[model samples]
Target: MSQHQILNPADHAQLRIHTEAGAEFGDNVMASLAMPAEFREVQAHYPIVFRRDAETGKLAALALFGFEAGENLFLNGSTWEARYRPMAHAVQPFLIGRAAEEGAPPQVHVDMGHARVSATGEGMRVFDDTGTATPYLEAVANMLGDLDYSWHESDAFFTALETYELVEPFSLEVTLDNGSVQTLVGFQTIHEERLSALDGDALAALMAEGHLARIYMVLASLAQFGGLVARKNRRIALG
Candidate 1:
């Protein structure tokens, strides 16, 4: 259960958030929601794919960390192996909340029940003694802002892909050195053939909206699959 509360210095003065990456802090996940704004950095570390919401039928991008659920290949001990973690994953235990009034600005809300919510005073303070937001809190706020904006804007990006039929079902079967096999399905990726076949006008529209570059980033990120498999193989060998 989540205990989300509006973050305020008065109410959360002594709250300290555990900043390390580990399963206890809910870091052991196969994937995270990816935003197009961060695709350039994400592409260098994780494979980007798309998944559709069963209820809304809306497409959302994901940055793959492993082939199976609860298996984060990039997680080693208490550290995240990747140099760049997707903002959605980085901004954990805190989320953007809106006010009851219409058009009110977003508020920072913290999950008091999260493991990262340090109960024994073992992590970074959210606010200083003077009730001022600490540098850590400031950074989290920025990440939340970026994530909120990018997530909403992602709808247009996905819509453009859908309109052009540029997405296709994707699946992968990995064979580890130990003869263990893993299969991944129910994902989608950019359809290179359809994208290439788009006429000049379609290309110009996508380029004008800056979706073309992001599309290419998703394509480029597929290369990281090999590295992901290598990480899995290493883990198996170690065991």
Candidate 2:
């Protein structure tokens, strides 16, 4: 279990956070949550897709990594080979906590057991001896702020897609060079047919909400799948 505690400089003055990128850092995944605000960056490296939340059944956007689970294509050696790493993936060990009272600001909490953290000062210090935030901590705080804002913005975009019936299930079947087949399923993407069916008024609403561009980004990002499949092929070949 995660031993999460409120991040206070007094109690965590010695806290250090690891900045390494690798499987040891727990970035192994086929996908990570993506925000509409991040589509421009995410589309450049990863395929953006949507899936239904297992609990809420609402459409959720993600930056795809590989064709299967627990396989992140961007990982090479100990580095993440990408120009842009999603904020959802960049912010680790620290989580945003809701305020105990309504209207209060959210609090930052750190997972003491997270592999990225070290108490022996092996990594970047979160605070100096004077209990002041370090540059690393400041960056994390900024990232968290962006993540919080993106969550709301992305949620609104998904709601708009749902209202217009523009989200639908997607399937992929790829034949690798070795003749093996990789069939990907249970994912969702923007439905071009339904999206095209939108009336002028509905189209105007989506455009006004800034959802139009993000939707096209998701569609365009699918081109990166060829690279993802190639990465998988390399891994298999090396093994």
Best by lDDT: 1
Model 1 TM-score, 2 decimals = 0.98
Task: Single out the weakest 10-residue window by summed lDDT for candidate 1.
Answer: 174-183
**Residue pairs in clash, model 1:** none
Question: Candidate 1's residue-wise lDDT over 143-165, tens digit each?
Answer: 99999999889888999999999
Clashing residue pairs in all predictions, respectively, total 0, 0
Candidate 2 clashing pairs, residues 3+ apart or interchain = none
For model 2, residues 1-239, the per-residue Cα lDDT tens digits are 59999999888978888888878778788888888899999999999988897998888788988888888888886888898988888898998888789899988889888888876668899999889899888999999999998987777888898888888788999888778999889998889998898889999888998989888999999999988899888888887
RMSD of 1: 0.7
Q: In candidate 2, how many Å is residue 105 off? A: 0.9
**Where does model 2 exceed 4 Å of error?**
none
Instruction: Give Cα-based local distance difference scores for all models.
Output: 0.95, 0.87
Every model's TM-score? 0.98, 0.96
